[model samples]
Target: MSTPKMFNHKTQLILVALATVLITVFTLHANGYLRHSSEQDALYISEFSLIASVPGAQGLVSTKPADFIARCDGGYLVMDAAEKVSKNLTGVLVDQKNRLISCR
Candidate 1:
C-alpha cells in the first residue's frame, strides 16, 4: 500500500502566500480603500458660502465671514451659464441644488 503525499513545504509556503495576498485584496476592496481614481461615484461637491452672524447670536458666532473660497479637485462651472447636467441626479448636493433652483 502506498501512502498519500501531503502538501510539501514549498507548496505549503506558496499556498499561504497566495491566501495572504487574496485576503489583503479582499479586505482593501471591502473597506473602499482599493477604489480607482477615475470612479466618479466617489466625487462629491457642495457649495458653501459665508453668512454674517447677528450680534446677539446664541452659539459661537463671528461678526466677519471669511473671504476664502474652498476649491476641490475639479473645474469650475458657473451655475448660471452651466447647462443642465442631466435629469438623473444621484448625489446629495446635486439633488439639493436642483430642488433649490427649480421653480415649483
Candidate 2:
C-alpha cells in the first residue's frame, strides 16, 4: 500500500507564501528598517546648591537667585520654597528665536 500525502500542492504553496511574508517582516525588523515614532530630546541637569537673600520681599520665595541662575544655564535647580511661590518663580528664558538660552 502507498502512503497518503499529508498536504496537497495548493496547501503547500499557501504555506510557502505565508512563510515568505513572515521572513520578510523579520528581516526588515532585524535590519532596523521598520519605521518608528521620533523620540523627543532629553534634558540633563547638574548638581549645585546656592542661597539668596531678598530685601523688602514679602509673601514667599520660590527658587533662590543662584538656583534661578543655574536653571538659566541649562542646569536643574530645586528650591525649598512653597509650591505657589515656586510656580511663580519657574520661568523659561528664551532667546529672540524662541530657543532656550539656558544650556551649559
Candidate 3:
C-alpha cells in the first residue's frame, strides 16, 4: 500500500516558513534587544520606581536620571536620578504616553 502524504511540498514549505518566523520572533523577544532600555534619552516614565512621596510632586527613582524624559498632559518632565512626577500620582507610567517604544 502507498503511504499518503500528510502535506504537499508547497504546504510543507509554508509551514516551515511560518515556524521559522515564529522561532525568530520568540528568540528576539527572549533577548533584551526587543525592548527599549531606560538609558535611552527618551524613556517611558512607567519604568520608574516610586520610592517616596514629596510635596508638589511624587518621588520617583530611575537608574539613569538623564533619560527621564516623559510626556504628560502638561509637557515633558525631566527628572534627576531622584525625582518626582507632578501628576497621575497613582499610575505606574506616563499617563498618556504609556505605550513603550520597541527597541528593535
Candidate 4:
C-alpha cells in the first residue's frame, strides 16, 4: 500500500483561502445579498414598477435569461444572458438609481 501524502504549508494555506471564499459566496447567496441571473434581468423602475412597462430592445430574445439589463453609464446596459451588451442599443434609458425607464 502507498503511504498517504501530506500537503505542504503553502498548499494548505491556498486551500484554506479557497474554502473561505467559497463559504463566503455561499453565505451571501443564501442570505439574499446576491441576486440570481434571472432576478437581475428584471427592470424595476419606481414609476414603472407597477405599470405595464415597455419590453426589452427589439431583435433581442424574450426569454428570462436571454433578456436582461444592467444600468450603467447613463443607460440601461442590455444584458445577453449574464453579460452586458456594449453595442447597437437603439433607445434605452436609465435614471440616477440605475433603473430601466424605457427600451424600444
**Best-performing candidate as measured by TM-score:** 3
For model 3, the superposed segments whose C-alpha errors exceed 4 Å read 36-104
Kindly provide the TM-score of model 4 when superposed on the true structure, using C-alpha atoms. 0.37
How good is model 1 by TM-score?
0.35
Q: In candidate 2, what are the lDDT values of residues 1-104, reduced to their tens digit?
A: 99999999999999999999999999999999986653321222223333356687554545655333333333533223235334344444444464554454
What would you estimate as the lDDT of candidate 2? 0.54
Instruction: Give Cα distance to truth, residue 3, candidate 1, Å.
Output: 3.3
11-96 per-residue lDDT for model 4 (tens digits): 99999999999999999999999977653346442232233346863443435543334444444444322335434333344566
Report the Cα lDDT for candidate 4.
0.56
CA lDDT of every candidate: 0.53, 0.54, 0.54, 0.56
TM-score of each: 0.35, 0.36, 0.38, 0.37
lDDT of 2 at 49: 30
Candidate that would win on lDDT = 4
Residue pair clashes in candidate 1: none
Deviation in angstroms for 14 in model 3?
0.5
From the highest lDDT down, the ranking of the candidates is 4, 2, 3, 1
